[model samples]
Target: MSVGVRRVAKGVGDFVIEALGEAVGEFVLSLLACALLGCLVLVAYLAWSFSPRLTIAGAGVLGLLLAHGAWQTFRTSTKGRRRGLATLTAAAFGATAITAIFLLLYGTGCDCW
Candidate 1:
C-alpha cells in the first residue's frame, strides 16, 4: 500500500528469489558432477571388462571407491535416517561388486562358454 512498505516487500522478494536461485544452481551443479563421475566409472568398467587380467583388479578398485564414497557421503549427510540408509546401500553395492569380481576370477575361463 504505502511506498515504503512496497519497497521493503520488493527487497524481501528479491532476496528470496536470489537465495532460491543459488540453491537451485548448487543442486544442478551437484547433479552434473555426479553424472560426470558416473560416466567416468562406466568408462573405466568398460575398459577393464575388455581385459581379462584387469577385470578383477579393476572391479576391486571400483568397489573400494564406492565404499569410500559412501563413507564420505554418510559423514557429510545432514539427515540421520537418510545417511544410515545411503551408507547401508553403498556398502551392499560395494560388497556385491567385490564378490562378483571374485566369482568371475574363480569361475570358468574368462571367455564366454
Candidate 2:
C-alpha cells in the first residue's frame, strides 16, 4: 500500500477510536446522572409521603433546587455530545420538581385567616 493510503487508514482508525471514547464517556455520565436522579426521587417520595408539613416543604425546596441545577447542567452542555439525552433527563426532573412544588402548595392551602 502507498504511504499516503497507509496514513489515511491510520487517521480513520484514530478518528473511530476518539469517537468511541466520547460515546463511552457520555454513556457513563448519563448512567451516573440517572442513578443519582433515581435516588433523589426515592428520597423525595418518602419525604412527601411520610413527613410533617414543614419537612415536606423542605424536601420540596431541595428537589426544586436540584432540578434547577440539573437544568443548568443540561443547558450548558456542548453540542455534538450527549447533551440531548442529558437535557431530556433534566426536563423530566424539572417537571417532577414543578409537580411536587404544586402539590406542596396545594396541600398547604395558603390562606390568611
Candidate 3:
C-alpha cells in the first residue's frame, strides 16, 4: 500500500481498538455491578435465616444503600450526559422499590426469635 493509505489504515485501526476497549470496560463495569447486587441479596438472605430482627435491620440498611446508589447513579448520569446511564439508574430505582416490597412482606411472615 502507498504511504498515505498505510497511515489511514493505521488511524482506523487505532480508532477501532479504542472503541473496543471502551466497550469492554463498560461491560466489565456492568458485570461487577450485577455481582455486587447479587452479593447484597445473599447477605440479606443469610441475615434473614439467622434472625428476624436481623432481617429487618438488614433490609433497612440495604434499602438505604440502594437509595444512595440510585441517587449517585442519577447524579453521575445527569452530569456526564449519558442517556444509557440514566436509563440504568431508573431501572436500579425500580428494582430497589420492588426489593423493598418483597423484604417488607418477608419480614411480616418471619417468626424467628
Candidate 4:
C-alpha cells in the first residue's frame, strides 16, 4: 500500500478511537451538557436536603423535564424522528414518567428501602 493511504487509514482509526473516548468527554464538558449536569446535581441535592418544599420543587422540575423530553420526541423539526418510532418512544417516556411519579408518591414499603 502507498504511504499516503497508510497514513489516511491510521488517521481515520485515530479519529474513531478519540470519538469513542475524548470526543465524548469534550461533548459532556461542552456548555449545554455541562449546564444540564449542573442543574441535575442541584436538583438532586435539593431533593436530599433539609426541606420538604425543596424536595417537592425538585420533583416538579423533574416532571417538567419529562414533559420537555416527551415534547421533543414528538416535535417533527426538533426531534427528527419518524412518526411511528416517535410515537412509540413518546409513549415509553410517558409510561416511565408515570411510574416514577407513582413511586415518588407511594413508597415500595420494602425493608431494603
Best by lDDT: 3
RMSD in order of candidates: 14.4, 16.2, 13.5, 12.2
Q: What is the lDDT of residue 44 in candidate 3?
A: 71
lDDT of 4 by residue, 34-100 (tens): 4544565687776677787878877786566667668866566754654765566567677776755
lDDT of 4: 0.64
Local distance difference test, per candidate?
Answer: 0.66, 0.66, 0.68, 0.64
**Ten contiguous residues minimizing lDDT sum, candidate 4:** 104-113
* Candidate 3 local lDDT, 1-113, one digit each (tens): 89999999999999999999999976665555555556777887787889989788767866666676577655645365546554565577778777657545443333332
* Clash totals for all candidate models: 0, 0, 0, 0
Model 4 has a clash total of 0
Model 2 per-residue lDDT tens digits across residues 7-111: 999999999999999999766655555555567668867877786796777867756766665766556555545555555656667776675574454423423
Lowest lDDT block of 10, candidate 2 = 104-113
Q: Give stretches of model 2 more than 4 Å off.
A: 60-113
Which window of 10 residues has the lowest lDDT sum in candidate 1?
Answer: 104-113
lDDT of 2 at 75: 69
| Quality of model 3 by C-alpha lDDT | 0.68
Model 2 error, position 86 (Å): 31
Return whichever of 1 and 4 wins on TM-score.
Answer: 1
